[model samples]
Target: MKKTDIILLTGLIGSIIFSNFAGFEKKLDKIEHEVLRMHILANSDTEYDQNLKLKVRDKLLENSDEIFGGCENLEEMKIRANEKLDEINDIVLDVIHANGYNYTAQTQLVNMEFDAREYGDITMPAGKYDALRVTIGEAEGHNWWCVMYPPLCIPAAEKVESDEQAAEDYFEAEELDIMKNPDKYEVRFKCVELFRGLKEKLSK
Candidate 1:
């Protein structure tokens, strides 16, 4: 091949690769901004440890009513979460000690990817989200997760009006439709799951 032709071909290939990467990154960013998440990891897969995780989760959710109720956006919720981290830790500690379990709780805010997850009538699409992660002891067990900012973890009856309000305030029409009926967007959901997996692997 001629030298100029070779140079042009290489540049074309590089541009294509760069464009695809940029598109993927943009999608990830969009997904991250759309929702806030929560994860509670138990110490082990044992029944007692798993139950303790729920105890911690329930207590945290109960105590978070005010913070979640007032927050209007992910950034606000994250700020409130940082302010209440110590209180959350104490709650977890109390639950552990009360259950006669000697384990530690670790909490932090992080960016993590999730597959499609259903919460009653709502389904969160697969994507990277900013979350409050609470890990107990080894943190090797199956975990519980929920949307904390939209307050989906709260009782269905109590949060119904709030959730609808939040949806109207926070999400776009198409996004809200997908969350409300994810099965209707099955193909897109699967594609999101696949890309999330790819993004996770690339980051690792």
Candidate 2:
């Protein structure tokens, strides 16, 4: 092969790779913006504390409708969450006290980093996301998280066979495709994560 021909071929390949990465990045950004996650941290990793964490989770999930009902979009969901922060805190405290613990809980809306997580058949890509974080007492134990906006965590929520169907209303077809078929875009997800991690580090 001629040197010029080889250079052109390499350039074309690089262009294709860059284009794929950019597309994935855009889809990831959209998903992040549309989704709100719930993060609950326990006081400690002891069996008792862990069980207490779940009790708090149960109480919150039991009241998911009150906390998130009537919210149309991510923005609305966030506003409603902020408006009900005190109520949420009260619920957490009530559960803690009822469970025979003195641990205090704090509820707040915050933007934070999350690693790639799988829920049933869906694989959410790693990135920064807006989360309703509830920290219990010392918050030194393992944590639990889930999608709150699309009502994924609600027990009475609709059951869908795939990610595409589950988020069809909130995501474009191509974006849903990426999430539905994570294995097909595994490399691209990693690339996007690497770039996002670097950007976050640099910003800090």
Choose the strongest candidate by TM-score: 2
**Residue 194 CA displacement from its true place in model 2, Å:** 2.9
Per-model TM-score on C-alpha atoms:
0.72, 0.87
CA deviation > 4 Å runs, candidate 1: 1-31, 66-69, 157-169, 190-204
Model 1 TM-score (2 dp): 0.72
Model 2: pairs clashing at backbone N, Cα or C within 3 Å: none
78: Cα error in model 2, Å: 0.3
Candidate lDDT (C-alpha), each: 0.76, 0.85
- Candidate 2 per-residue C-alpha lDDT over 1-204 given as tens digits, one digit per residue, 9 for 90 to 100: 999999999999999998888887988898888889999999999999999988888899989887778887788999999999999999999999998999888999999988888876677778889999999999999998888877677632344344445567667788777777889998888888787778889999
Candidate 2: stretches off by over 4 Å: 1-9, 156-165, 198-204
